[model samples]
Target: MRVVKRINALVLTGLALWLIGTSIAGAAEVNVYSARHYPSDQAIYDQFSKDTGIKVNVVEGDVNGLSQRLQREGTASPADLFITVDAANLQRVKAKDLTQPIESATVNEVVPANLRDADNHWTTISLRARVIAYAIAKVKPDEIKAYEDLADAKWKGKVLARTSNHPYNVGLIASLIAANGPEKTEDWAKAVTGNMARKPQGGDVDQLAALAVGEGAVALTNTYYYARLKGSDKAEDRAIADKVGLIFPNQDGRGVHVNVSGVALTKGSPNKANAIKFIDYLLSPTAQEAMATKGTSEFPVRAGVPQPAGLPALSTLKVDPLPLTKLGELQADAVKLADRAGWR
Candidate 1:
């Protein structure tokens, strides 16, 4: 009877050891649900893993789809971090209670306060300016100096942009509302809608292409799109880049409206410690430099990183200081204003 009891105890001990081993292995990796599909992102992840010996398992999808998956998984979700572009999407995830505040002194010290969430629920890792793209042959560089300039009578039927509901447009209008009162912004939106070269259609590149072919005088697009075209292997893309000139809008006022590619800690973070370490690693100089010069072509959130060739240094550009958190808060209002203004 004593022998039998000893054997049972040994079996239970082995089972406990196996469970402990499984947990340790799992804790050595982080599960990332990332909406950023850039091929350069994988290279960054690989570098992180090489440096820290912690595996980065990424599940790539669009923001809305990934957000839905998080909701469906609930607390049982294994996602350690959620990485996506646009503060508005981060705000949506926070509103759904899918994210928790990121508690890392390294992250706080590295990223600017305006570029991070007010409540620490998210932080931007890279930035891209929403600038005016114009045809040098059509619009003089000084003609459209600010976003407000687009609504002027002279620009009527000459502005090209994507649909108003796009997150990029939403973030842009939200920044406008933050700068100007809602009433004035709405009026501006209405006038800008009337100024559209055609009904809002296609992505930023398409808008730029339209401007390139003389379909419009100017278009609103993120800066990186132009960089991508300039660096593209295809002759046609480089041709579009050659024909288009960019105006960093509002440099004399609140500065150009810039948006971010940001990240957040999932509320259901299974490997919280490892996740935090990974977040810290992303903000490091090596990672920042990699992101900037890699296929992404975005400015690093960290100061002093080198800009891509032919692009102005980040320090030279006057970026809007409005806390990006406001982008999320005012997103709904921005959407409503766009709808009322016929920016469909």
Candidate 2:
């Protein structure tokens, strides 16, 4: 009887240990493959972990690199979610049929119709306006009022821009195609190329630096690039930020063209439920505000979120109402148009 009771106690202890191990194994965790390498994103993950007790594992890389990696991983990929910088990149992943449609009340409530994928494959969390930045000392504010006006003869040899091959530029051209017909867009591309102050080179930030040093009087760039500069701790960058003024062109007609940094769940995500939760966390009011203030100086996608101080109000600017998905579809055409126009 003593031997039997001892055996029973051992069995019970083993069972208790197994139960505890199972609970630990079942604890929720989500894996994220993201192109946005920002400290604010890490903050969001920390907050989400605190709020939900679910661990977030983030892996960062270039947008195209992450997308290709997802494709290579196929169904066995450990990635629960994917985030990227542009709508075009999001569309590329969607085109691969690697993303599953998400139905989350948080996403629908936070993101506007134009900023998300129609099939619910992805949703934009933040927006960056493509605007004209001018050297404050050289260009008069009233001289440049619209995107079309940039092609005017007087502006020729006075503009600096990134390569038309850049995704941001291509997205802006795509917006032109949506607003005007293809013929008009093609002409505009050719005319703008003629206005180049120098051969298109470098990123948007480089264009702003050029404007500061008088390399060019005006530049086509996104708003956040200057915002980033202004927010930088480096004094030289801040000085450059001081020299340029942002102009939301086409405000009178079709407001400014905006692009987004967005996210989606892989179609074969092993943890679909956890992926949805992660996306919802990103759209939460706390997350939205965090993005505006801490992540990128970008405007939040969520309605009613306060605009970051010193930035133009989203409501006041007339945003082109083109669906973001169309931007991806027109990307190839926009690139071809740039090539044909010799906008290197």
Candidate 3:
């Protein structure tokens, strides 16, 4: 009888220990698939884990790469959250039905209506303006006042840009479509393409470098590239950044075009509850501010947060009232129009 009681006690203790270990293993972990490769983002994740006691598992890669991976994994995808650098990429993920609507009040309150999905599938954490960087020696500040003016004949053989296939360029075209209608935007694209300094071949940073080298007088790119260049430790890079002046085009009309780096919860996330919590944490003021200051040289999507130093204030700029949702919807059409206009 004594031996049997001891055996039973040992069995009960073993079962209790097993349950405890399982609970600890399961405690508050969220898996993230991200296209943003900045060290600052890693810091944000670290802070989030420390504050919430939620462990984060991050898989880093390109936006399209991660999107394809998510599709491949389908319902079995271990991704609890997806993050990427552009609104078009966010739209792509949302279109896959791989992201579910998040009803976090904190998100809704922190992120602006224009920077989030209508169904709340994603929320932009930071904002970057699409501005023109001009070589100060070659171009006068007053010569370029808006995006439309890039098509002016004076700029012919003096414009540098990335490929029209880039999502940033696509989004810019989408914004033009939103502001000026397809007909005018198509005309603008044709005229602008006629003005290309060279075939569109490289990223925004390269475009800026080309401008610095006098290959072109002006380059259309995100503001962050110049900011990064200005902050670069390399002497040549710093010189290139120094020679360029940022122009917030279209301020008199629709203001400058902007895009976002955002996050969403995966549709079939294994840890749905933890994912929601993570999303909430990401949209929190702390996270948004950190991203703006560190990760992308962008403006925080949260209303009251001051934009990072050196960026034009959002309030000062005459932003279009068009919802970003429209931009996402019009992306395919924008690309088609750009292609038709021979925007290489």
Candidate 4:
């Protein structure tokens, strides 16, 4: 009876050890909950795995949805990192207390000060500029000199945009607030409303398509969308793309409006080491090269990485000076102002 009891105890001990080992192995692999849905993202993750032998697990979803999920999961969340395209989403995460600050020397070196949170809570990896697009035959290149210029009476009944509530528009409005103050920005928003060719409806691409159909003469769109259309496999898309000329507005003053796809270390990351490694890897030249190449329509945020040919090199455009975090704070005010301005 004594011998049988000893064997049973030994077997139970071995089982517990195996379970602990499995948990540790699982923790070594980073779990990335990302809203970035680009196909090339997988390639970068795969490369990171190949180099470091650390596995990457991804959960792709909308930024708002993922932010809610992280809050619901709380301290028990297995997420090691949260990736998103907009600084506003990162601000949302920060507001939810769902992320922890990264203290990596590598991260500091790779990301520029202007492209990251002041406290290191999140870091931008790539950039996308919202530039003004005009139907080539309808408007001259000098017609729009800046974002503020779009509100001129000449542009009445010619502007196209997404909904006022969209984060993109809100961000732009926020920048306007930072530059020209609430009162002036509101006037600009009102002017934009007066100039709309129709009710503000549709994504950037839709606005571009409307331009092609003569519904509007100018539209606000991201650089990548235009680049994608120019390089699209569809001849129809290419045709519409060719009809519009991209204007890097504010070149003489504030520079173009820029947003980003960035990452934050999730609170209580089970794989902190691997998480930092992955973030650093994203900021590395290797990943930057891949993201800026033919597949992905973004510019690498890291300096010294050669931009892909035909891309608007970051150095060439005048970028707005307001930090992205400020954009988040101004967003609510922008929304309220938009409501008052009758921007639909």
Model 2 weakest lDDT span, ten residues long: 307-316
TM-score (all chains, Cα) for each model:
0.93, 0.95, 0.93, 0.92
Scored by CA lDDT, what does every candidate get? 0.92, 0.89, 0.86, 0.88
- Per-residue alpha-carbon lDDT of model 3 for 36-111, expressed as tens digits? 8899888988998999888999999988889999999998999989998777788888998899988788887777
Order of the predicted models by lDDT, top scorer first? 1, 2, 4, 3
lDDT of 2 by residue, 1-344 (tens): 99999999999999999999998887688999999998888999999999998899999999889999999999899998999888999999999988989889988877888999999999998999999999999988889998888878888898899999888999999889888878888888888889888999999999999999998788899887888898888999999999999999887887899999999889888778888998998888899889887778888888777776568778777888889999999999999988988898
Superposition error at 61 for model 4 (Å): 1.4
Candidate 3 vs. true structure, TM-score: 0.93
Give the C-alpha miss distance for residue 179 in model 4, angstroms: 0.6
Give me the candidate number with maximum TM-score.
2
Clashes in model 3: which pairs?
146-250
Off by over 4 Å in 2: 1-4
Per-residue lDDT for 45-141 in model 4, tens only? Answer: 9989999989999999998898899999997998999999878889879888888899889778877787888889999989888889999989899
Clashing pairs in 4: 255-318
What's model 2's lDDT at 88? 95
- Over 287-321, each residue of candidate 1 has an lDDT whose tens digit, in order, gives 89888887588988888887765467778988899
Clash total of candidate 4: 1
Off by over 4 Å in 1: 1-27
